[model samples]
Target: MSEIALEARNLYKVFGRNPAQAVKRLKAGETRDDVLDVGTAAVIDASFAVQRGEIFVIMGLSGSGKSTIIRMLNGLHDITDGEVTIGGDPITGIPRGRLREIRRDRVSMVFQHFALLPHRTVADNVAYPLELRGVAKADRRARAEEILAMVGLAGWGDKLPSELSGGMQQRVGIARALAADTDILLMDEAFSALDPLIRREMQEQLVELQAKLQKTIVFITHDLNEAMFLGDRIAVMRDGRIVQIGTPEDILTDPANDYVEQFVQDVDRARVLTAGNVMERPRPYVPDTGGPRAALRQMKDAYSSAAYVTDRDRKLMGIVTDRDAVKLVRKGENSLRSILKPVPQSVSQDETLMNLFVPAVESPLPLAVTDEHDRLVGVIPRVTLLAALGPGPNATEEITLPMPPLPHAEIDAALGGAESAHEASANEVPTIKAPANEGEVR
Candidate 1:
């Protein structure tokens, strides 16, 4: 596990002049409403760790105390009770001066509004954080220019915030926070002000940046879809408390409570589901040198008619089918290379299921799930892929009739004879139809 970059230990924040009395009541098992009877209880016993370089999202509807929790993390909101630590230093009740130093050096926040300076040039706005720390003007300017380029605002830095679009202004806000060179980012609805299309664009950019920058981000959002897309793990808040914390798949497939279940019931599974979710442990394969006889025997044992062929390093070479194996054995061929046909379809583990539709439909072979090195990891059979998208308002329930059975009879038995005659043709492992001219899928 990654080292904890930020931790909230029983963190509590009550928002009122007599907050201490409310905290005491809350500690003694009085509810948030009861605490509110005395004074506002904005957060109650919220605790979670933000691991280094992970996007930890806190999400809930309005008034869920998510924003309050983030404020307490950066010491912007006074903690009523419990502790918060940043980079291993206890932050609750720290001296104001020390708290300021931690906020300056270890953490930065991006607010919902762009918060850009209307009159300042983008470069100046981005450099403002560095300027506060007494960085040399030239050094800060250079840093600002570099970060602007990273955010895709390269030559436009000389323009003022008023001259930029909403998305661009948000980028400036992000650039300013990044200029502080902090390890933690507390972004509270930072992209909420943008147009829907632009908000999505900003989200994609943040995802891309996270791939390169690896900063520890605490993203607060009310949109469940946004939370599912951006968060490595999510904390769902309600009534000043966290109700669930889990990965997107975990939250979707196994909701912790009815509230969470209702919250995610409408989520687009295809958008959130990846090839990794549907892929099965690939059946055993043979090296290209494994003769036709051995290949045939293995296929029979596995009740499969086709087998993947790979090199010594497990790099995919091609696929060999029962028909080809039979012909090769008849011809007394020692190696399976002559009969091997190039893999018809493949997907990276992270490819969203939405992107796999065309390939899944067009290919006869199971979709190959390959790693970055083009080495096969597992396979997503058409049956399994269809099953994942089975009967739902958002899914094509009609897919049941067209889905071919899995390659093995054992699987057919397990599936209660969902296997059909159409699937038997999989024995030939139909080759991907190429343009009459080009030879490869790429």
Candidate 2:
């Protein structure tokens, strides 16, 4: 199956008379203001692809056309001049019967106001979509109960919407959408109406649900922080046009324009940037066979007091200091095992800098970054960590201390020399691979 679950191409939504003519003017050299006499262009030439099981957030201030764009995606609002596809099927110009089928079986929506049927019980409200589809009463009720449990509503399914809190009602709305068993979920400011704490709680619940369900989600919001917290990739809209689309770190570190720069001026960089963003290539190190002589040489050449020891697969064994190396050499010992010190601390590449501050300060050496298999992938030097956390617009700038040679080449040469002297085996260390895009928010 194709990876993309939803797509919008050259989308335009013009409100007013003769919207078609307004689209033509927009395609031409005319600005939005120039076409004001004809119609208001709500969404102008918006284009984006949402991968399956991804959360794609459309964010902007009021009247930026974020909501308008979402409405057009599910055919709730007619597209002035554009196409929308769901699961590789074009839904823009299909017949109303086909569109309704797509809405019922492929797409589900959650609104901001928690549009629950007041008279019906919560379980009945969740089962309403299945009821419309002629599902058996027992089947739909069982499905409703299952979905209610998934969204943390559980036994509250029997209570009326009026008896539940605002947060509970919103959960019911989500439950209703999930009961449709749709591939795509369109949430239009689904949590904006709640109080601050409740909104945060809802956001957390949505993230947890997405982790389990992996639905293709197109979420609309006016809050920047919420967008950053929940969006796998955020499309920032301004004045009816999408200005930039990127991950949270990309938006914070490399904004596309002045508007976006100003828009993200107040964002907390430490929260958005992970260790992967700030870590550099691992420093020169000695192989396990290299011993104290090679370890001392590496520390001298790298102009450092310590050297890391790793196996052929780049799994870190321990660290050896120049002081320890000197003592071992004087004693005529060839192995570094005696003086090796255990790593003080280490962090995974996905750890955020906010959680790294205390460990980074407490570690005696550069912070070690490991992959899933415990192989050292990168290191965050003290200077690099400080620069990343310091106050500045460019939080992603690389800061490195002076070094003698390329890290990999120097280590390779040291290991080669050690193997020849000791008549031991040697192998080239693998470089760190870039992290894959997992369609996750962080």
Q: Which candidate is the best by TM-score?
A: 2
- How many Å off is the CA of 235 in candidate 2? 1.1
Q: lDDT by residue for model 2 over 1-442, one digit each (tens)?
A: 6499999999999999889999999999688988989999999999999999999999999999999998998999999998999978999878999999999999999999999999999999999999999999999999999999999999987899999999999999999999999999999999999999999999999999999999999999998888988999999999899999999888988899999999988777777788888887776467777777677666655566676788878889998877777677667788888888898778999888888878776766678788888888777776677677656555444433232223444544433444453343332323455443211110
State every prediction's TM-score relative to the real structure: 0.85, 0.86
Report, for every candidate in turn, its global Cα lDDT versus the true structure. Answer: 0.81, 0.84
Screening candidate 2 with a backbone cut-off below 3 angstroms (N, C-alpha, C), the clashing residue pairs are none
Which 10-residue window in model 2 sums to the lowest lDDT? 433-442
Which parts of model 1 have CA positions greater than 4 angstroms off? 284-290, 297-305, 393-442
Instruction: Estimate candidate 1's alpha-carbon lDDT, on a 0 to 1 scale.
Output: 0.81
